[model samples]
Target: MLAKAFYPTEYKKQKENSWIRVCVRFLLLITLGVPSNTLGSFQITDDISKLSVLKQNIPRDYNISVSYVPKELAGMCWVKLNIYYLEESLNELAKKFGNVSSNKNDIKILIDMLQDMRLPLGHLDPIMYDFECHFRNEQWQTEQYFDYVKDLLKAAEDNISDDCDPPPCPTTLPTGKGFDVI
Candidate 1:
């Protein structure tokens, strides 16, 4: 016990060819203990339309907006204001915006109701919104949307146009690529 404690083995006399093994062990230790690369977190952004769909919060995208319609005298007008609200689906979208049609369940009338819908700038019309939705969501169901839009256009041309009314440009509808148009 006394010899073991007093005459500890010296390092110079014990090992001969372990330098490579030592370096490999040190490198492996560093590779395992220390982080050599950083990892990135995944993220998904919430859009205004998705907010309406999710119904998680108040929709302020169209809050600070107003509409103006010139009266027959060209000097004054009484605008019928519309307050935008989120609906569950297309049926509800039509039911809530009933002023656009005599038939409440009419999808064509619902498309027309978009005219009353406004953006945060209050510069939107139904036709514009229709085009905006289509333009914005490239994956949107165009055939269904266009069927209603065409019907609304026909109704406007046949029953509403009085020569003094603004012409409907169904063909030149805006295709929004981003938030610029909506």
Candidate 2:
């Protein structure tokens, strides 16, 4: 019975190095003492606050302004309004007035907005997208949601160490090594 209970099929399958990596990440998280939920807090706040600024900048009657949208329905319109906000910010920066120096503040805000936009392009998207699909389904399943949460945890763990390095280009080869065929 003990041998049967300890069988490989009954155990969680993971790469040999995976537990070491998990321990290191777990220790790193503990050492930092930062709650996992707060990982994207700053970026999320920056994204939300930009809406108010964009709302204030655009005229109330402006066609693309989301100011008129109800707060309850905001999620439905968020992505569209975010794109419009970027465009409107760029347009504002492009214009020059008699007195005001073409709002450097707007340019800074735009840069932050672009960074916020790029944040979602990180590796967590596929897991989040899967979660989204499950969330949208008419049938609710607790087991699936639990699995989604686990996947999300793993994705967050995987992404926690990402330093956001730029991709290799024709001009730049990766720094590590060249393979030698035996």
lDDT (C-alpha, whole model) for all candidates:
0.31, 0.37
**Model 1 over residues 1-182: C-alpha lDDT tens digits?**
35654333455434534776788899998777542112211111122223223222223232211121212311110111111321113444344444745333344334334343322214435433433322222222323333333333333223322132333324554445322223
For residue 165, model 2's alpha carbon misses the true position, in angstroms, by 27
On TM-score, the candidate that comes out on top is: 2
User: What TM-score does structure 2 among the candidates reach?
Assistant: 0.25
Listed in order, each prediction's TM-score against the native is 0.16, 0.25
Clashing pairs in 2: none
TM-score of 1: 0.16
Which residue runs of candidate 2 sit more than 4 Å off their true CA positions?
1-42, 65-107, 119-182
Local error of candidate 1 at residue 20 (angstroms): 6.3
Q: CA lDDT of 74 in candidate 1?
A: 14
lDDT of 2: 0.37
Compared with the true structure, what per-residue lDDT tens digits does model 2 show for residues 1-182? Answer: 35545656445555546888999999998887774345653223243344445445544444321111111323332232233333343444435323354334544555554444445544443433322211111211333322332332233334433332222222432232221111
